[model samples]
Target: MCIIFFQFKPHSASAYRFILAANRDEYYSRPTKPADFWENDCNILSGYLVADFLTEEADGLTYLKKVSSEGHLYNGFNLITAEFNNTKGDTMCYYGNKSGQEPKTLEPGIYGLSNSLLETPWKKLVYGKKLFTDTVKQCNELSQESLVEELINMLNNEEFQLPAPDIEEQGQDFIRPMLKEISALFVRTSSYGTRTNTVILVDAKGHVTFTERTMLNPDANQWKVSSFQFELEI
Candidate 1:
């Protein structure tokens, strides 16, 4: 299943002036669910806020409702408005902003997923790094205040390297169940003497995803991927 948690804070006096921020999650078995697609967006729930006030009855569609909120969703993403509704009536409301702005590219950090009140825990997704799964687990195991402080510290840590994969060619007539698993793959292209990198992360299930590249040195003549890092969640 997919779930989205958001925080909103007002930035101005206008009725529509608010900020929207959120994180999305999908089950491993349900990779195509809503959360996976809307991963890092601030505008995922705007339609509901402008149309109607969400209530106990609006379970299947997104709408806006006034309730206690956790994070300042209105201030987090510099959003104007958002929507919330229980389209499926599972007691889980779908919320997002009206104007769509992708937050994944803005910065690398950890995002928390929460219910309407923003006090309860749902799940968390880590962005721009290979240790996402582990980080999430650690956060879930910490005290509320400790989790917040630790999470911020983790996000603030200097960007590290992405590891390289082991590549080999097999003989034309040979077949091998005896192949080594790819540890990691660091893909980079250099042109104009400047390097651009894209980190492809592969989970244990063999699913591959991408991450933003962090340059190793500021004083270096040109930027290049320093390394690729990998870790098993188990």
Candidate 2:
């Protein structure tokens, strides 16, 4: 599971700015130019170590200091555009240009949402390094419309199969207590033939009680039929 924790802090000017600190396990969607990059929707820089400045006695201290002295490490309120070398009349990899300003060599591959880093100095402090890519690929099953037809046909012919007697009895005993703890539920349906992976959370009372994964065959109506259901704890 890829989980992101968004820590928000209020801004001083009443504008829509926020202080964002996230730790995520999933790959990010890469951003291309001409389209404004959505930080929440895409990944940060390809290679950024937030823990580099954390400890005084760490291993990469000298190297990080050298990189920091070369240029500004963070920018606010704008996306990071590639930096150029004006004197050399050429583009440089380690440097980045901000709002058409002169490029500065900070380090290679450190990026984030514009203006997000300034308020949170802790963001620059990286304690470890990891190799990762933030790219989102288009779904491969998009063009095959026949997948939906197959699902509809399967649902129409299949019979409902209940869980084993022992599991069913166990469910009866545990399901009620689990249902009280669910927080929310979501029902998602993709286009005809498209696959759907959905999760439903139900809180019976105050605690999480029931969780389920319902796989369904896509059809025009709700009778699309349930392919499978599993009980879970929150």
Candidate 3:
């Protein structure tokens, strides 16, 4: 399971500016691929990683310190997009719902996204919706610790399940089993589950904070965490 939920700031000069929190759930046996800034001209660059003061051009634009996720290590169909200040004053962004099978304009507003239904699972969507909405509503300041605590709680909401759609209906399934709850932002399928929980925060001042918490030894028993802070060079 892979989820990407962010905030949208339409109409404003920094409109579509976003703060993203996402998780990747996959089988441990699936040789996991990592994230990095665009490297060689290979297909893997689609889900790549970012480096400090590093820059690479892809998707028709140059990104400084750009990184991506290839879903699972072996292979998967997923690419995440977060708008950033690429060129000091560039004002372009992805405004439609291409992640879905069809073309649809997500009405301007605040929303979250999950791997199940890319457009914020309309099933258990409210849970996610509320999670983000309350976050924006209540929290006066968004820090790495606050984001971690908030997201960890959200990911551990086993009871939170979107009403599953019918089989053969051509829709993704939203079934997160209620197992021995361990971590705040992870799940386990005997051997496979959320390998990492990431929080990316971009404030109104062009400062960027990226934090990643990964499971050590592929076991949800513990987390090895790291954070990076930098200014988005315009």
The TM-scores of all predictions, comma-separated, are 0.22, 0.17, 0.63
> Over 4 Å off in model 2, which ranges?
1-39, 43-143, 152-158, 174-234
Output the TM-score of candidate 3.
0.63
- Model 3 agreement with the true structure over 40-59: per-residue lDDT tens digits: 63222223343221333453
Whole-model lDDT, candidate 2?
0.23
Give the residue spans of candidate 3 off by over 4 A: 10-17, 33-80, 86-108, 141-144, 160-163, 166-186
Can you write out model 1's per-residue Cα lDDT over 1-234, one digit (the tens) per residue?
A: 111212221122222111112222112222221111123443222212322332233422222233213223553222122222123111123333322422111111223332221222311112222233344345335543343344333433333222211112321122112111111111111211112222222222222232222233322243332322333221
Q: Give the 10-residue window scoring lowest on summed lDDT in candidate 1.
A: 185-194
lDDT of 2 by residue, 172-191 (tens): 66433322211111111232
The lDDT for every candidate, in the order shown, is 0.25, 0.23, 0.50
- Order of all candidates by TM-score, from best down to worst? 3, 1, 2
**1 against 3, candidate with superior lDDT:** 3
- Lowest lDDT sum, 10 consecutive residues, model 2, at 127-136
TM-score of 2: 0.17
